[model samples]
Structures are given as C-alpha cells and as structure tokens.
Target: MSAQAVDGLSRRGLLKFSVGATAFLATAGVTASLSGCSSSDTAPGFDALRTSDLPFLLAVIPVMLDGALTGIPSQSATERTLHGLDSGLSHLSPEMLKLTRQLFDVLGMAITRGPLTGIWSPWENAEPGQIRHFLGRWENSSLELLRQGHSSLLQLVLMAWYSQPQSWAGCGYPGPPKI
Candidate 1:
C-alpha cells in the first residue's frame, strides 16, 4: 500500500491507465454520437432529450422523484417532470447542453452503461431497485467524474420535479411571496 505501488500497480502505471481511460471515454463518446447510437432525433414530444435518452430518463424519473408524485398519476407526473427537464435543458448554453447530452449518451449506450452503472438490461426493462443501486453507487463512487454525474442527474431530476406547482405542497414550499 505504499505511495509508489498500491495493489501492485506502480504510480506511472496508474497514470498511464488514467490517461488511457480518458482517451477511451472521449473516443467512445464521439463514436456513440457519430455512429448514430445516440440518436439525434428528439424523444417524442420532447424538445431537448433525444430518443436514445428517453428510456434512461423515463426509468430514472420515477425512482428519483419517489414519494413526490403521490397524488398525481404516475404517467402524467412523469411526463410533466420530463417536460420540465426538457424546457430547462433547452435554455442551457451550447457547451452545457453538449455535456448533458454526453451524460445521457453514456447512460443510454449499452457499452458504457453496463460498466459504469452495472445495469446490463435495457433501461426500459430495468427495475427501480436496480436504478436505485446504480444511482447510489455513482453517488458514492470514488471517481470524481462519477460523483459529478450523480450530482448532475440529481439536480436535473430534483429541479424538474420541484419546479412544478403541484409539487410545492409536498415539500412545504409556499409559492413565492405576493410581492
């Protein structure tokens, strides 16, 4: 467990591995987009999220929103939350939008998703527990990139859900002061 070697990997070897992984991720992202695996077409009725992103988004929304959808029908609530997310994303700067889409591509592409999130099944077929486990794992991951991805997903979902008027009462947030 010395600084020079941990788990039998030398510092230089670790550095090389990190660089290689970064290159792989960059290449995979470009390939995913150019190869059409990350569809450019928008999801049905969505302004920002792509068709390839819908399955992952649909699966994650309910799990992340959890108890917040109480009184509303799940389908209706999910659609509204998704629309909120879409609207929010539509306003992002081009760079931010590209990064967000890349995050979705990572989740949508099977090659990246399985290794990163450990969910090999198509997102449409993924169970809530499986999604929860992935989220928890990413949130607690030692990798800073995974942690940032977790934060981005959490922020998007939470902001989308809480922005809806119907959700305000659930969180005890009174509407903005009359001023």
Candidate 2:
C-alpha cells in the first residue's frame, strides 16, 4: 500500500504491471468471444460480412452519407449501400478483409461496443443522433484505433454511396465522360 514498494516491486512497477495485466485480460476476453462461434454458425452472406453486420452498416450508411442519401427512400438506399459496400469489401486484400471482419465483430459485441462506440443500443434501436455522435467521437478520438475505425467506415460508406449513378448529380459529375 505504501508508495515506495509492495512485495518485491516498486510502486510504479506494480502499477504498470496491473495496468498491463488488465489490458491483456480484456483483449483475451474479446478475442475469445469473437472466435467462439464457428463459421457454420454464422448466417450466410457476402464474402466479407456476416448477415448480422448488414444491419450495423445499414444504420451507419445514412448517417455517414446524409447528403447523398437525402430524398432517397430509406429502405432502397440502405439496400443499395449494403450492396455497394459488399462489392467494395470483396475486392479488399485478405489481410484487409480480416481486419475489417475483426472490426465488425468488436462492434457487434455488447461489452466492447459500448465503450468503443458510445452506443449502448443495438444498431436497429440506435437513433441517428446517437450514431452520428459515436461517429464524430471516433473520427476525432486521440486513440489511433478509434481514428482508424472511423476512417475505414467513412471511406467505405462514401465510396459506396458516391459510386452510384443516382449520387452522381449531387457532386455534378454528369456520368462517366463521353466514352
């Protein structure tokens, strides 16, 4: 309990050890949960994403691409965005796909999800305001992982939404040059 030493460890060393141990345990727990289910247990879907992940993306697309998605019916826009995201994900390298899958798994978990995303509700129940706040936090977070997650999601959503012909007019592209 003294600041000088505890057992054989200096107080500073002991504090460091405790922090490291806690982080290791937390990471192990998350990895175990993510790997607990076999591939066959997952609902069938795109090459990169499980069926459960689609709902999360559905919730995110409109919030991230609000301008492009405006005036488009929610259901149809969500469906098209999902398709575009899947197509884009399919072309990623295996390493990138693996990383993306891990990100989705973390977001899917109730434990890590709340702390990381600040959205305690399931994707379906999450309000657009809550999702937007979470996105903003991640985008502006000092942590590298949070920033990377925000970047990845934003890039994927923007690419998927803007690639559509319907979105072309929003940016004034006027359809693939006269070729």
Tell how far residue 152 is off in model 2, in angstroms. Answer: 0.6
> CA lDDT, every prediction?
0.86, 0.72
lDDT tens readout by residue for model 2, 4-81: 556547656766865764474357445844576213133465655677576678788878877665467767777777
Using alpha carbons, what is the TM-score of model 1? 0.88
In the range 1-179, model 1's lDDT, one tens digit per residue, is 67556745765676676677667666778888888888777877888888888899999999998888768877877888899999999999988988888889878889988988999999999999999999999899756677898999999988988899888887788988997
Worst 10 residues of 2 by lDDT: 37-46
Against the true structure, candidate 2 has what lDDT?
A: 0.72
